[model samples]
Target: MQAQRKMRIAHYGRKPVKIYGKTTQIDSSLMANTTQEEKRCSFITLNSDPLYVAYHDEEWGVLVHDDKMLFELLVLTSAKVGMDWTSILRKRHDFRAAFARFDTKIVANFTERQIASVATNCNLDLKKV
Candidate 1:
């Protein structure tokens, strides 16, 4: 019988982590003193506002299958064209109130007068509405 050769597995010293869509090596020592929340969040979210960090952790890449939620995401993304995400997140409540809770049927039937009224009441840009 022929003898079988043993296969060896190579081990890398450092751990490779994906940060902001890029893969990079992270030193375990760097996270020694961080809290559980900080350790679990991305690098960009380390020093960000709590609300922004919460969004990153809870909803940034999570899938949405609900119609109302999908509509809300679409509206928020469109509103972010010239604005920052933090601003949009902060005004989420206002958008919901102004857009009829993102009910597709309700928003689809909005008249110019209703749009103008919503814009004025919510202090939103008229053109954006």
Candidate 2:
């Protein structure tokens, strides 16, 4: 049997879709008959994963400038050693909260106490890195 296929947009509020098979564009007439509920459900599913879909659509694999931001991404990527990127992405806010907005200077100065605190916070998983 063929594997079940599903597609999702990388970002919320948008419907950039990808198909697993060769079906390119369905007929407009056919789509016209698709229920609004179905369309909405499909869109929601695309953006409903554990991570922020908008970030994938907007940032993943895209070239980033800004040395500070680049450094931040690098740190997070390294922190993701054995974990999924989506998990890290979902906890981005928690990281920012703990690390003081990814300010290199601030993070660099983090005390041992701060490090210990973050290690226990369930919102983020930083032990691997």
Clashing pairs in 2: 10-53, 11-53, 11-54
Question: What lDDT is reached at residue 68 by model 2?
Answer: 73
The C-alpha lDDT values of all candidates are: 0.68, 0.58
- Compute the lDDT of residue 121 as modeled in candidate 2: 73
The per-candidate count of clashes, in order, stands at: 0, 3
Candidate 1 Cα errors over 4 Å, as ranges: 1-43, 121-129
User: How much does each candidate deviate from the true structure in C-alpha RMSD?
Assistant: 12.3, 8.8
lDDT of 1 by residue, 1-129 (tens): 011110000111224656689986544444454444532433555468778767765676554569999999988887787788888899999999999999999999999999888778766675663
Could you say which candidate leads in TM-score?
A: 1
* Model 2, position 127: C-alpha lDDT score: 55
lDDT of 1: 0.68
